[model samples]
Target: MLSVSWCATAQVFSPGGGTGVWRVFLDPIRPGGPFSVTAEQRIANAVDRIILKDVYFGDVWLCGGQSNMEMTVLQVINASKELTLASHYPYIRLFQAGLNKSLRELNDLAGIAVQWSVPTAEILGKGNFTSFSAVCWLFGRYLYDKLQYPIGLVESCWGGTPIEAWSSQKALSKCNLSFNVTNGDQKHEATGPQEPSVLWNAMIHPLKRMAIKGTIWYQGEANTAWHNAEYNCTFPAMIEDWRKAFHQGSEGSTEIDFPFGFVQLSTYHHRVPDDSFPWIRWHQTADFGYAPNPKMRRTFMAVAMDLGDEKSPYGVIHPRYKQEVAYRLYLGALAIAYGEAGIVFQGPFPKYFQLKNSTELRITYSQELAVLELSKDIFEIRCCTMWNYSSCKWVSAPIVDNFFNILSLSLEQCQQKVSGVRYAWKEWPCNLKKCPLYSKSSKLPAPTFIIPKNDHL
Candidate 1:
């Protein structure tokens, strides 16, 4: 027999399964638990029993992404101190999904790399790129410090995997993409798992039944090779589909439009100049250069351009300063997910631009700006007599005046009228925390952006 109970209500059902498997549904329960569940079966004189102990109910967050999210605490900066602090938070539970892929959606996880366990120094200081994730752990720890409750973190991540691997076929179809692995795809050349929907099948789909409060991602580097342009559509579609699937699977326990958060792509090679990284950063927010936009609603972003690690043992592409990244993410979560009032989670953005004169352009920010001591040639302008992109070249637009929220630029180097303007348009724009512009209140670096010529401007 199957039974459902909550408070004073109870419903019972007769055992009607011939395959020897029975399922029961329970209503949603409040958070905060160290409860237990037991099951028993009897046939004639024989009896069988099973029990699960120390189970908890809390805000469950699914941390998904590539290597950065998989980077362990042992590989981060101040590793010893971080590992020592892990023992203080017993309410923060951790689970990691093993690396596996399937061609079809699965109802259960293929493997469990690390079962739900309380954090400890030994558990947190595991092998690099292994069970415990630095970003995920630090984020959960910060949340527990604020909410003062249990926080469940499930890590489903694989290094060098593209966003396609995490997204389903239904989601990809919306972006005009399919699961067609070919030799011509450059993104799959030197890769492990690049096939679409494989990781989703084995890792993400299995967790649909387990209701999650939200998700945080740290990917897009793998897609920079080829799918950077399509990410504006593919990424948003994937979020929408994941929300719908989880809602249906959990029977409305999870919100349809839960608060989604992600870390923007950090710097790669410092000396090597490439536009791919900047383009992918823009596309990460659906090309709006920020989150919670119309295309990607109920979302927040963490900018990591200023926290670049150029001398990391793992690689420059993988920054070791995950503590700052997780702290920024926690701020966003507090504002967007928890609905805390008067939280400035994001940095200042460009509100508008004005042509003060033929050789001068004024850019106004969305909030009060802080001019760092190291501010320099981080701004550029494209100028041409006609709309000929080939003839127009980008020249340094030095800051002549900066007051409060307005920044005035000198365009004397331009031979003709400026066609567009851009800021910090480089893989490595400046030294660590030396970015020219930032929000005075939040202390967060302004995200890279490009504004082309428009009629209103």
Candidate 2:
């Protein structure tokens, strides 16, 4: 067998795993001689070696997720227009990898497993390019346009793959997970705590010490199914490990923390009147709460609850408006990564609600309010705090008919007298009245209002 070598001097290939420069020489032509590669195989091997060498000397952006991220330009709208307008920044490169699970420790450089390429129709259709993570490409393209930097997008996603399969065996062992290391049982394997640090070992470990601004994630739909408990810790742990690995140590002894943003799973699965798996949606929503660090905790979640169409296939489990998804991601990046400081990536949420004098529900808000302009309509306040705290739902301001959208909640429908109000707290029908203005970007509704059972707020 031919053996490859890495040395400072010129490469000279030797037989039997010897340590020296690798030189391509034919083996002895005996009856049992082993240098019998077909002409096609030899050509293929030579081409792959050339590509591998090229990839060794470049930077890449790693993207991992399920099929939504894997959706392609042809699947979404304006494919022709988008391709015609595709003038890629030369330095901004793109790479993709298979989303295979590894029971064993992956190579240190898992993140840089593929070669970078320019965005051309031919390049995109080369391998499994149609399944490349589209959201990542859109985000990178946008960044390249605005910043004019050398951006590299690495698509490391698989269609219909669960988050557990992508995790590391070592990490999963800590979480008490079990899955067949062999025999390809994805379903049986996904039932356990995902192998922890698998992505780090395969994707992040390889790129450790590589200078990257930050990472943007668009996954967790699989984790939403049955691994909520494990995800609670695994998600946070993954963020920390990535931080430590890519840490450049800029802020004194404290390593410089980078912004890690993610796309919020949209509300396409809302099947009202049927309460099956409601907890899954809730867990997906909670993932929005995870941030990288206390300092650069610059994490944003784009709410896609209203963006999805009801007619879209629920059985498919894939979001149809992928371009919109990418745009929403870009919105978060612009606000958090680029620091626009002007827009709200999602709607405002109610912090706490209170009953006042046993009469009306007093709802209070947290942080800065963005869509209060929508509240200018009736200018009149409702007397009831419309909230659904039992299931952790979001409530949008209620609008009445084409005239007035309800602003505040002051209700008299509690065991005692209700004193606070909320909006969009339950799974309800859409009322365009809920939102008034045509937001230039994604509009997040206010939070659920909370009322103390005892005192007034």
Candidate 3:
């Protein structure tokens, strides 16, 4: 028999026959704590006791995704300063799950790369792609700065893995993908961590029993290469399935519709021109081109189109400026998770577009817009004459007027009626903080978007 107590309440449980494993359920407690937990058991004539000290009851956020989420504090910009400042937040606990994969769901974690511990300079600035995650750490640190309470962050991520690897088979089915596995088949050879449901089985499944506040993800780069088309379905399916799994695992303690936050795919290659990256960004929001939409409710997004890092030592694909990324995510968490009001979590987005005439088109934004005056070719229009329908081409549309929340563009360059319009639709749209459009108050960059011929205004 084992008995556990917390907040002056006691629960008794019996260990199972062979595993000697028992579970104790506790009533919900308020979020701030540096408290302790003790488990006691009695044998024939002796007593065994285990005490866990400095335990916390605050929000526990699971940070998951690819290399961007795996990048450590040391690999980010101003690493030394960030590491030193990490010591100031003793209440922020960090845990990193070791890299592992399984063909079946796991009952417990395979390994813990970094156990729950308070942040330290050395610990924060550990290996390049191991242990502490800069975005996870900074997001928790920012939350602690505001909430002034304990914040637990768990990093369970693998680099270069697609969303399928982290999603369950049920989730994949939503996208019409079949992920099959044979039980007790040790001969199965996994191509890598990218195998579907492997990371979910070995890393995410085990942690489901633990209650979590929400999740912040930085992925979609891997999916950009392949399965990019299914992302709009797969991504939202994964979120829905994870929420269901966690809620059931926690015995309904975790919210069924917990908040989710994700960083839209950032720039990949400055010189390479492709629509894959921009398409993934749009798909990440279920093709809504923004978050918290009908398909993905209670969610938020951080746009990284303008935060391109062309000279990063690690690689241009891995932006070193994770602080800004984390800060933007933190703002979303404030509004979505913490219920903070008057929070400008998202940048200005196009509310609607109107074809003023044959030579002009006007776009109105959700908020007041500001032009950084960085690029002249951010907007493009597809035009094709009746005789040249098969030879349609996209031409640059110059901004004729940008005032308040409305932007007027000249369509005179297109000799024929414009059929499509797109903005910032490139792997690298602009230099860091130099995107042409942004929210005047929040300074957050507008997300990339495209309006097809049928939907063009």
What order do candidates take by lDDT, descending? 3, 1, 2
Looking at candidate 2, the ten consecutive residues that score lowest on lDDT are 32-41
Model 3: residues with Cα > 4 Å off, grouped in runs:
1-6, 15-20, 183-190, 386-391
Candidate 2 is scored at a TM of 0.65
Off by over 4 Å in 1: 1-16, 19-25, 44-46, 180-192, 387-390
Top of the candidates by lDDT: 3
TM agreement with the true structure for every prediction: 0.93, 0.65, 0.95
Deviation (Å) of 235 in candidate 1: 0.9
lDDT of 3 at 7: 44
Compute the lDDT of residue 108 as modeled in candidate 3: 90
- What is the per-residue lDDT of model 1 for residues 315-354, given as tens digits with 9 covering 90 to 100? 9999998998999999999999999999998988889899
Clashes of 3: 0
lDDT (10s digit) by residue, model 2, range 1-457? 3322231223343455455532243322212111223211133246323212222222234566666677665555565666554554455567766444444545444333345566764444333335445577777777766665466677766555555555545445546765545545454544222443344456445444445555666666666555755664555555555565456322222135556666655443454542222233333334233222242366655544444455544332455566666666666677776688775565544455544465344444444443434342222223333354343322232332221221243332333323223333223222322433223243554322223233434
Per-residue lDDT, model 2, residue 82, is: 60
Clashing residue pairs for model 3: none
